[model samples]
Target: MAKNPDIKAIITTDKDLVINSGVPVFLSKNLEHLQVLCESLERILDASSHEINDETVIIVAR
Candidate 1:
């Protein structure tokens, strides 16, 4: 997916789902531009809460 210009982001999780592995794992890719993507996502989550509304939806795709 990284090879595709149209693919902006990609999310993945471990089999146990005990942790958000993507947050740290992707940082290791060492691409400055891609590193920002992970940082941005972490910021968004840190700035928001789990109190979602009825109209809100979250999807985690492998």
Candidate 2:
């Protein structure tokens, strides 16, 4: 998979704690560029999001 130059950051969390974060970069033409960006973001989140354990509980504050 290609990286995305425009993506600043990808954040992931579990049990109110950050589990992972990443930034991706890649070079591509117009349409491919956008696709890469979107794909990168998806990969970032997918790579970061993890299954929780019985002792873990995710919490968020608005």
Candidate 3:
């Protein structure tokens, strides 16, 4: 019933593919870049980031 706290963004180093969801997706050059992007995005979007793997991270408010 609520999507406010749901996925707000996505960060991935993989440039080959991405989902078609409405969430904003950020592409990074490498793992380190991904982490740095995640940190900046987390603060900017006021959400927490979760690493789905070494190449991917999902951002959510809760």
Best by lDDT: 3
Per residue, candidate 1 scores C-alpha lDDT tens digits across 1-62 of: 37512222343322232244343333223345444554575466443212122222122222
- Each prediction's TM-score versus the true structure: 0.26, 0.26, 0.82
Candidate 3 Cα lDDT to native: 0.86
Candidate 3, pairs of clashing residues: none
Worst 10 residues of 1 by lDDT: 48-57
> lDDT of all predictions, in order shown?
0.34, 0.36, 0.86
Which stretches in model 3 have alpha-carbon errors above 4 Å?
1-5
lDDT of 2 at 41: 53
Instruction: Compose the digit string of candidate 3's lDDT tens values, residues 1-62.
Output: 85555888889988775767798888899888998999998998888998898899999985
Backbone clashes under 3 angstroms, per model: 0, 0, 0
After the best TM-score superposition of candidate 3, give how far the Cα of residue 26 lies from its true spot, in angstroms: 0.6
In candidate 1, position 54 carries an lDDT of 27
How much is the lDDT of residue 46 in candidate 2? 46
Task: Output the number of the TM-score-best candidate.
Answer: 3
